[model samples]
Target: MKNDSYPTSTIANNTKRILVLFAHPVPQQSEVNIFLFEDAQLLPNVTAVDVYAEYPDFNINVIKEQERLVNHDVIIFQYPLYWYSTPSILKEYQDLVLEYGFAYGKGGTALKDKLFFCAISAGGKEEAYQTDGFNHFTIRQLLQPLEQMASITNMTYLAPFALFGSRSASREDRISTHREKWTTLLNALATEHIDLDRAKNIENLADLTINGANE
Candidate 1:
């Protein structure tokens, strides 16, 4: 079920309608993203859709998904990083929902000027995602396909807000702090308080402070 219950009229002026497409294969086993999804539900002007819950059979409703995309100003893919990419359902959703005549190719400008980014929770440590580290690539580098997808669809791509070391976060008591940061990031995006230009330059949105400190 989609949480499109929040009315647009109740949202404050100058705020954008944000759509968070959550895709986790096993939410019952998740430590971070489940809480983050709940936090997004409490916020105004944010429509959070659990894609797995909505399409358990992998039968995506292209029209409805496209409509949701058209109505929102920002699109966020919220999920745990599974095998260096999104979960299977999310990839299916994109392949089906984003069609040739709608998302890209000729006369496919339905998502033009919309903002896109990922909110990811990874099992590896932040240091492990560097050029010379274990993964041998930054999260941004690993997510190049989605960035290019956004570019072709005419959406503005922002650096992801990622939480590294997620596997031990709950045991180390870091989940709460990460959840709080996720909420803050969502609020900043909704209210247009974040610096889009600066966001584009950064590798991770989490490193940029919401206030004037990081600029």
Candidate 2:
């Protein structure tokens, strides 16, 4: 299913296409990411790619990945944070797929005007990512690299969608609530309910509570 976007969902007919690149090293053992990724795949007009599952060999085909990018309207990089960044395979994919004369440079407008952001599951609690916290840097601060990548590529870089404390003890109800919000956010993104300006202004999608919905 290389660059595949079959119409499995009937949520919206003429909405923008969504590409969710799901990267988990070991999904079966995962507690939070598994549920998040599973729910995302069920959304209509959304192409969710389990990167590791698709390319277990780590030998990602650049052409196929680029083709998928060109064909989608919204792009999501969903993964569990490792060492404050994406997993190795996704880094490898970027180095190979986002090449010269393609994603950047002359005639490299495949991703222009497209929505770019990430959905991350981190072990650190929300407060841990603040100035006075142990981590000392906000998620937004740490994710500047990807945000810069979007800038250079001429894409619209919105605030990230993050879930903190993935490894901590959490109630089943809390996890269920997170899933509901995740699904709602995906639907909003697909249907263009997200106001790009407002999304860009906030720190993350979870902050939507303070800023109100993207509508």
Candidate 3:
């Protein structure tokens, strides 16, 4: 995986170590996520990993992945939402790296108290993911499995930060706005400026705004 880390001296004091596990099967076709991923790489106290690029053979190193998790205070799963779930490689990564003894079930507390969340881009519009809409479920409802995974692993699960209408986001200013929000959120998360309680209660963090008031 591509690991991006800032020098120890350059990192802000008391900032959280953020680990972004980015997964995109075909990044060239992406209109927005690739830019967000690139922005994440430029931030201090953040480690961005392109999982697809690193584990093309599906041969993930379990020990190293566990170590990465242990070292970071925040974990972000960044990807394009596929069939209301994560990409196959990420699922595979979980299966291989989050072993019974390492993540849960009897003395497993490697990820305890850490924050976990996803950054997803959806092809459908926000309205289409409602009870009466085509998807017949909210984005939060569709992501229960991951939430439960975080719970079982002893990590605090936050609402996902999602971009809807992603297919057409590039046509207007939506893509640019979304990228700006992503950067702002990342910075807030790194500096512990984000309110965790509010984060968990929100449906999504796409429109999240952090200010001195919240801090």
TM-score of every prediction relative to native: 0.91, 0.89, 0.92
Q: lDDT tens string, model 2, 1-215?
A: 22233222233466888899999999998888788888988886788899999999998988788878887878899999999999988898889888766777876666878889988888998899998998999999999999998988888998888888878625534677777778778888777776778888788785664322234
Off by more than 4 A, model 3 = 1-13, 212-215
Return the lDDT, model 3, position 53.
Answer: 96
| Residue pairs whose backbone atoms clash in candidate 3 | none
Q: Write the per-residue lDDT of candidate 3 for residues 42-125, one digit (tens) a residue.
A: 997789999999999999998789888888889999999998999899999999988776788766777888899999999999
Q: Which candidate achieves the best TM-score against the true structure?
A: 3
lDDT (10s digit) by residue, model 1, range 47-115: 999999999999999878988888889999999999999999989988998887678886677788889
Per-model tally of clashing residue pairs: 0, 0, 0
Q: What is the C-alpha RMSD of each candidate to the true structure, in Å?
A: 4.9, 4.8, 4.9
- State the lDDT at 14 in candidate 2: 64
Off-target runs (Cα >4 Å) in candidate 1 are 1-13, 212-215
Q: What is the lDDT of residue 24 in candidate 3?
A: 96
